[model samples]
Target: MMLSCKEATRLMSMQMDRELSMGERLQLALHLTACAGCRNFRKQIGFLRTVTRKFGDQIDDS
Candidate 1:
């Protein structure tokens, strides 16, 4: 079964916090393959996560 964009987005956000089950991963991947918006959302969130982690690391170093 395909996931809705809302569901896919939720899964993507949840992914940052925890590991997704095989079923959730498969569904989100399928949705992302066809949905450009969700794909972009995933990329943006990933970029934000990277930046946030680096910022946190810099703060720790300070």
Candidate 2:
């Protein structure tokens, strides 16, 4: 079954916190292939995560 945008976005967020099942990964990938908005959201979240991690690392080094 195909995932809705809401489900796809939730899965994307959840992935950052934990490992997704193979089925969830496949479903999210399929939805991302067709949904530009969700794709953008994924990219934005990824960017934010990277930036946050870098900032935290800098603070830790201080």
Candidate 3:
């Protein structure tokens, strides 16, 4: 079954928190291959994760 953009994006978000099963990874990859918008979203989120990881501790939590 094809994953919709919403589902794929949710999986993408989940991936940042923990490991996904092989099936979930495959579905997200398949969705990203066909959906440019989601692909861009994937990149943006990836970038955000990287940035936060590098700077998250530097920011003061209020």
- Listed in order, each prediction's TM-score against the native is 0.81, 0.82, 0.78
lDDT comparing candidate 2 with the true structure: 0.95
Best by TM-score: 2
- Highest-scoring model, lDDT: 2
Give candidate 3 regions above 4 Å deviation: 54-62
RMSD of each: 2.7, 2.6, 3.1
Which regions of candidate 2 deviate over 4 angstroms?
A: 56-62
Which 10-residue span in candidate 3 carries the lowest summed lDDT?
Answer: 53-62
Q: In model 2, what are the clashing residue pairs, if there are any?
A: none
TM-score of 1: 0.81
Q: In order, what lDDT does every prediction score?
A: 0.92, 0.95, 0.91
Please, what are the lDDT tens digits per residue for candidate 2 over residues 1-62?
Answer: 99999999999999999999999999999999999999999999999989988996677644
Order the numbered candidates by TM-score, best leading: 2, 1, 3
TM-score of decoy 3: 0.78
By TM-score, the better pick of 1 and 2 is: 2
Model 3, position 15, has a per-residue lDDT of 95
| Clashing pairs in model 1, backbone N/Cα/C closer than 3 A | none
